[model samples]
Target: MKYSILVMASPTAGQGSATAVSFARSLLARGHTLHNVFFQGDAVGNGLANAIFPQDERNLVGEWAALAEQHKIELILCISSALRRGVLDKVEAHRYERAASTLHPAFTIGGLGQLVDASANSDRLITFGH
Candidate 1:
């Protein structure tokens, strides 16, 4: 089945993001097709370029990024939520007069329209953490 994911929790908030990652991987392994993952709310932290996690702990951001890379999935961060949380890409950072880009390269900034399009295009629209 063709699927898309909507993640709404921060990686550090709880296990919501982690669970989403695991679920996504499982679906793919079972022959599901995932092309888009939309990160909104605090979940946008998953696309932070400078986040550092301890060796013992899981770096959820990197995990999600790796999944996107390996699966050819589009990791999209909601532009409104991203800007509100200071997650800026190179173009946005420069446009907003920021010093540099703070968004992970694996993810792209997008509007809610993309979310709508994903929902319309995919057979399953799975959501995590509200």
Candidate 2:
């Protein structure tokens, strides 16, 4: 089956992101295809390039990046939510006259149309929330 995930929680603030990551890995290990992983609301913060984690803690951002690279998963961050949280891509940064873009390499900044398209294209759209 093809799966699309909707994450609605911050990576560091709650278990939602972790749960989503685990689910994605398990799905892929079971030979399922991941269509996309859409980060919305606070979840968009997960794609911020400036996110720093303590040395003692697991690097959720890095883990997600590695998983995305390994699985060739499409990581889409909601542009509206990302901007409101100060997560910007190169284009958005230039347009807003920002110092630099904070969007990470592992994710793409996209509109809700991507979400709509993923929903229409996937066999399942799972949501991970609070």
Candidate 3:
């Protein structure tokens, strides 16, 4: 099966995003394909590269990045939601004259159309959030 995951939960505040990652892992383990993981709303924070977590806490962003890297899957963040929350990629940062981009290299900033395309192309569209 091909799956597209939509995550709307805050990366640091809740379990929804983490649960999505775990589910993605299980799907891969079962020989399924991940079409894309779309980070919408607060979940776009998961793509921020500079987030600092407590030493004892799980680095959820890192986990997501590693998962994307290991599986070679697309990790797409909603450009609108991300920019509103100060999560910018290099191109967007330069375009908006920001000091620096905080987006992780493992993820790419895309418009909502990507989410729609992923949903249309994938066999399943699973969402995790409030």
Candidate 4:
């Protein structure tokens, strides 16, 4: 099956993001293809380039990034929600005259159109949190 995930919680705020990550990994292990992973609302934190988690704790952002790279999956951050939370890609940072892009390279800033497209293209669209 082809699956797309929508994450709506911050990586550090609760278990939602972690749950989503585990679910994604399980899906992949079971031979499912992931269409994309969309980060919206506070879930945009999953794309932060400067996030620093404790040494013993799992780095949710890094985990997601590694998963995306390893599986060649699209990791997208909702542009509107991202901007509101100060998460920016190079283009957006340059356009807004920000000091630097805050989102890691693993994630691409996109509009809701991408989410809609993912939903339409995938056999399952699973959302974590809201």
lDDT, candidate 1, 90-109, per-residue tens: 99999999999999999999
Residue 104 miss distance in model 3 (angstroms) = 0.7
| Model 2 regions lying over 4 Å from their true place | none
TM-score for all models, in order of appearance: 0.97, 0.97, 0.97, 0.97
Estimate candidate 4's alpha-carbon lDDT, on a 0 to 1 scale: 0.94
lDDT of 1: 0.93
The lDDT values for all models are 0.93, 0.92, 0.93, 0.94
lDDT of 3 by residue, 16-102 (tens): 988999999999999999999999999999999999989898888999999999999999999999999999999999999999989
Report the error of model 4 at residue 18, Å: 0.4
lDDT string, candidate 2, 15-66, tens digits: 9898899899999999999999999999998898888999998777888899
Clashing pairs in 3: none
Candidate 4 residue pairs in clash (backbone atoms < 3 Å): none
**Worst ten-residue run, lDDT, model 2?**
56-65
The number of clashing residue pairs in each candidate reads: 0, 0, 0, 0
